[model samples]
Target: MSEENTPPLPGYEGMPLAMLRHRIRSLGEEDLHRLMAYEREHAARTGVLEVLTARLDAVRQGAEPSEGDQGFQPEAAPPPAGGSPVGPASAAPASNPPPHGDPAQPARPKGDHRPGGGTRGGR
Candidate 1:
């Protein structure tokens, strides 16, 4: 079947249902809390929302280690014995993000070779 023809992801079921599933699947525990807050405020679904909300609460209370917080890292580490970044700050967003080349920095001009800092030398 064509990609377009394929049924949409489960969350497409409805805002309350589909978003809850997608949020639960894709988001970290902290993010799930944020989603749960929004879910409770608007478009709340008792059954589906409860499942996700329970998960959010479970994470908060340390009732159990979360689904896969087991080994995920800020930058995914090579998997090891212990799980996700541990301790109080692990769930918080990174303050300094991993580097990306700065788009604002000007690019070096192409084929503009020079000697002694300019085109001073004779050919």
Candidate 2:
């Protein structure tokens, strides 16, 4: 199919295959059919086709799609019990080094020489 004639698949771009499969679980028959058609015409990936086919079959067997699946939730870390967040006064952090090349190399001082001559011919 031509790029210009492709249908819009809202909320699917850049989504992982597992996430896409889960996201489409709630799609009705008509919508699922549309998605299947789109997949067949464009990517035709076997794994994707299998997932869509399985979901469609499940729907046909009267399995109602569940609400959004909450995959993972991370717990927040606790702060230190009593000590202050700041480090001790005597300890100092080193300055950030310049990017690129070796850090051990000495820094180069800026010079007055200009390359390709200044705007007024190589004066």
Candidate 3:
């Protein structure tokens, strides 16, 4: 289809995919069919096809259009082992190292006595 004639993506033109899928449930059967045909003719992505097909099928099965939050809900990341949750007062004391070592200050072996390895300028 020509650029001007092609339909806009389900939600606002630049909306994220998760939001688009949620909003797609609100489209009428005719709108969904139009979008499916457009997608099949243009991008033809399997994920997009699956969502469109499922929503269309639901419409055919007499399901009412969804009106609530059906979009993705991200789970909170688990706290690091021996590390505290992030907050304003979670900073470690200056004298002690954090449970996880800091990358800014690398560790070196104590009392190093390696033979003739102090300076790199000598042959």
Candidate 4:
């Protein structure tokens, strides 16, 4: 998954999402459909193929017979307690911060500067 596409997680949510996908691919269709239902009812992972899996099952099965299996209603994701990290969140944290106190960094400091003071343009 692209870094941009990966949702920010406080912890291990990212890995299971990715692993669920890998398992889906490995399982091919049947197992994928079962997992799709589980994921829909649980995480409601926002992936194209994952979402499609549930729909495909619905179409293939013909008439869900009830809304419970049609697809999942989105639920609020919970805070993770513990697990090994993975995905975008698993990457290293920022090592280098800009050496400027002012966060905006609007312009370069002018030359011919006095102690702790500088004009709009260097004199």
- In model 4, which residue pairs have backbone atoms overlapping below 3 Å? none
Question: Which residue pairs of candidate 2 clash?
Answer: none
| Two-way TM-score contest, 3 vs 4, winner | 3
- For model 1, residues 63-117, the per-residue Cα lDDT tens digits are 5432444123333245588777778876787677436556566556546567456
lDDT of 2 at 108: 74
**lDDT, model 3, position 110:** 51
Question: In model 4, what is the error at residue 73, expressed in angstroms?
Answer: 31
The runs of at least 3 residues in candidate 2 whose Cα sits more than 4 Å from the true structure, single-residue gaps closed, are 1-9, 67-123
CA lDDT, candidate 3, residue 38: 77
lDDT of 2 by residue, 35-96 (tens): 78888876788888898899889898997866643333122245769977677775677788
Off by over 4 Å in 4: 1-20, 48-123
Candidate 1's TM-score reads: 0.31
State the C-alpha lDDT per candidate. 0.53, 0.67, 0.67, 0.47
lDDT of 4 by residue, 24-111 (tens): 3323344445545554555676783454465466556662322232123134366788976687867888667667676576666456
Worst window of 10 by summed lDDT in candidate 2:
68-77
> Which 10-residue window of candidate 3 scores lowest in summed lDDT?
68-77
User: Candidate 4 vs. truth: CA RMSD?
Assistant: 16.2
Could you estimate the TM-score for every candidate?
0.31, 0.47, 0.45, 0.26
